[model samples]
Target: MASGPSDTRVLVVTTGGDAAGEESDVASSLSAHLPGQTVVRSSSTAAEYLRELGPTVDCVVAVGADADVVWTISETDPSIPLVVYGEEVLYTHVDAVIPSTASIDDLVARVQTEVSESRETNHLEEVNAKLTALSRYAKQITGCETVHDVCDRTVEATHDALDFDFCVLAFVEGDQIVPCCSTLPMDAERPIDLGEGVAGRTLETGEPQVVADMQSDPDATFKEREFRSVVSVPVGDRGVLQVVADEADAYDEQDVEFLEILAGYTNEALARLERETALRDERDRFHAFFEALPVPVAYVEAERSGEASVREINAAYERTFPQAADALGEDAADAFPTTGERRLVSDRLRDADPADQQIERSVREAGVEPFTVVLVPLERIGLSASGYLVYVPGTVPSDETRTGYSS
Candidate 1:
């Protein structure tokens, strides 16, 4: 069996007749085979001893102990490996049972094997728990709506999820990598060059870089020279996410993998923000053009209720028909409260084609003279939503136009 790590702690519990002698013999045998290992001999019951030592005990060896004691130890701490070294036939819960006739070497080898396997199992459990937490953090990062929010959450995840002390998220701005957010205060004016440091190298190669000992690395270019280890992963082509520590070899391949997962989440959030920003810019441009037109214009949308509603009206439209300002969000039929005028406007908009043709018709609102209105289909322009634009020419003399509509 493998000797395993030297830090293993074995608790030898001796019960029944010859307790002192049994404890001494077991301690000596374990110490002889496993050098630098800790052996604690206890005359107390198995459950009591385990309760006192808690998780500090890696393995327990019971000498001349009964089935009740072995069962109690298993119930107290199932994680602690139990080895019963008595001659009694034990149907109890125990990791291994050695015959009383067995030699000292057999006992030592069994304890070593159990210790090694126990450590491996515990390490795997810890890693799996950390990964589960990182998965939850990734969901929150993806839901972030802005680039700054994404960077903040990314840095927070480094500390909360991965347990890193220092982290920085930097984006490419021109030829320099600008720090967007960091756990430590960073100089915003003096950013890192796109090809200078560990983060720079990650961005350049589009891969993760792990430096076990930055002090000894010739390519290390971070301002904080006190940090001895660093891991940098690229956030797509947009930026790099980096974490550092004061201890050398603080990060392993597992640490790099976790950071890469977080970087991927940040990339998704940034991409979402980019798309939203582009859509907002497009809508702003469209609104500017709508307002700049000299003629009065009103945007109408077909609601789910099978009625056309006036969604928006330009400044010129509001000024020309002052009563129409209150008509915003009202049905088109109510906006033009003239006899048969509602059907006249709705039919023109419904029949308007996508070929960019403007259908002209004369319509009269209550208390206002008849005016020529143009129905232009807005679906072809790809506005944020499908709608129609109502354009009224400025042909009515100022004196002939009414200031308000009559109910």
Candidate 2:
């Protein structure tokens, strides 16, 4: 067992006759140099004292110890480093091979350095584990689709990765930041305003903020909520994600940085969801207008070859040409009465480029009345295809043409 950073234990073994005679002086020098440390001395030939104390000792000092004693120390515990004092010697287990003439200060410095290094190594391992958990959480949140899923995952992942007791993900709705997900129960009826608390301040400035001691800080109004420490990270311009701890000064700069990384992942996921929602709404509006149009209309998937297939036909199209409904999914050219009319329409609407706007072509379908068709490429309205919106307007050809679509 090794002592903690605050304290250390050093075991001194005197092997030869010369070392045994100077054991008291050597032990005193060691104790004086290492403050807040316990020093033990052993003179037994078999080094039984060293054996008994090896488990608890942090560092071992051999004063002119013979080969047998050194070998015993090495076999018992190779990890507990030995600082051999005497003429130049080499041992696999010995940490430092200093001459007998070397001062006590040299030995004290070596022991303290080794003990401090051991503690630091342990600390780094713990930090590495925490970072691994953070990475795993980032990967888990990528599959989330909805705003609710993003917010819930953000709060849950933070708790799982950092062990933060309380966490919340809020979104900017109108003039206020509203809590969408939280580890604790929230009052849905109440809204948290921007700039009201640490989280609010972070949202307003688009910066990460930390309140190390919420209860004791004069600037903090959130102390009424009873949290002692708080770290708030902004999620783009969208909102803020905050974590609260019960203990005062629980969070530091490292905690704030980790939360910032989490917020970055959350921001990207939320932006994608928002775009999808907007597109869905736009598609719904387009479907309503497509159904309500009074004119004979055929919405086709336009091709670079200027040939289009009728994806959907309105009621007016069915009334005008009842055969057109049964002819759904067929090329618009085949649905027309004459191949000449198909060539004419295709030529006028050339390549179905939305920038070319609307094109008109007149056609006489055998005995049927001659009518003018207006072809407007649906690509202008953000449809998937370089398609056209075909409608016969008032049975006449006109110079006036509509260029842009308004939603």
Candidate 3:
């Protein structure tokens, strides 16, 4: 079995030979080079010893012993590596079959290096899994439409993923942990004092802090002995976002680094969410204005041929022209033929002199109020129209002849 980084236990099974034989010497050398684990020599014969020492042995540092005996022992426990002293080695399962004459330091060094590399590979696989989870969280945070949504998700995701007993995300409002999101169930929200806690120190200095065992740690200020692990990672650029988690000695340097990376991406997403919210508010305000306008407004689309297409007409348009829907996107002149003493509105549209154009209308239908129609260029009304904002009868025509600079 592969042991931990600080330990490598090997069973030395040599022939019943001299005390100063290569196997006995290799056991002493292995003990000196490898830090932990005992290098023991089997007192029984190799055949008898192989049956006794099974999975407990990580490797077998074999010295000059019978090939039949060695092969008999090695085949029984293939997991245990065999580093031969001065024997022709023919085994596929051994990690490295070394000559027994090789220096003990070299063997120990190889074992230590392999053990460490395996641990690092495992840690990296764990990091990759964590990164995949954090990326999903990032997408959810940015998808939200409210600022509170961002804050709530940040605290919840951190708490659940890290297995922390307590978690509090605070915004840095000039040196205070303004409690924005937390997992304190059934408690009223309160701001944590910046100068009073470990989290506060990180915010004030813009550096991360972790107390592995809070009770024994000198830097830890909180007297709550139940909580052992404390980690504080700053979220924003230059300490603007703050995330602090408290567990039972679970948070390490690697965990802190992972949280910091999560925070950086979260900050950008929240910032964008804030801007979208503000823009939506502005659009809502315009909607209110569009509904309450005093004058009739028609959003008109102008064709290149100078024909007016009424895209939208307000409530006032229904009172002005009872047949407004039929008139929409239809030739304006065809809908209302020009009466005497009035120039054709279509003729003025063809000339493209929308601002100065005015036509008098007399409705033959009884009880109808005579009105004068004025056309202001639809483009000027924010609805680029060969179209015009036709006003009520009392409205005066704004000057169209005035010269102005075009942007």
TM of each candidate vs. truth:
0.74, 0.62, 0.57
lDDT of 1: 0.73
Per-model RMSD to reference? 7.1, 7.6, 9.4
**Model 1 lDDT tens row, 1-407:** 11236656787777747566766776677777775555565545557767777677888888777777767777888878888887653567788888867887998899888888888888787679878888998899999877778888888898888888889888999999988888864542248788988878888788899899998888787535578888999999998888888888888888888888889889988898888798789878988998887767777777444677788888877766656678788877887555333554455555544212222333335334444444555543333224545454434332332222212
Task: For candidate 2, give the lDDT.
Answer: 0.68
Task: Rate residue 64 of model 1 by lDDT.
Answer: 70
Residue pairs in candidate 2 whose N, alpha carbon or C atoms collide under 3 angstroms: none
| Minimal lDDT window, size 10, model 1 | 398-407
- Where model 2 places Cα greater than 4 Å from the true spot, the runs are 1-104, 107-132, 172-177, 184-193, 221-226, 296-313, 317-386, 393-407
TM-score of 2: 0.62
Q: Which residue pairs overlap in candidate 3's backbone? A: 85-100, 229-249
Give a tens-digit lDDT track for model 3, residues 1-407: 44354555656665655745656777777777776675565535654555675555555666565566567666776645565555565643345555656677777766665455544665676678777777777788777667688777776667655444466666766656676777654252466566756666776677777766677766565444355667777766323333334455566677787778667666776778766677679747854664466655554455655555555666666555556566666555454434311233344443455443334443335344434455544223233334445545542444657221111
Of the candidates numbered 2 and 3, which has the greater lDDT value? 2
Model 2 per-residue lDDT tens digits across residues 55-130: 6677777777766667787777776767777654555467777776777777778777866775576557656877
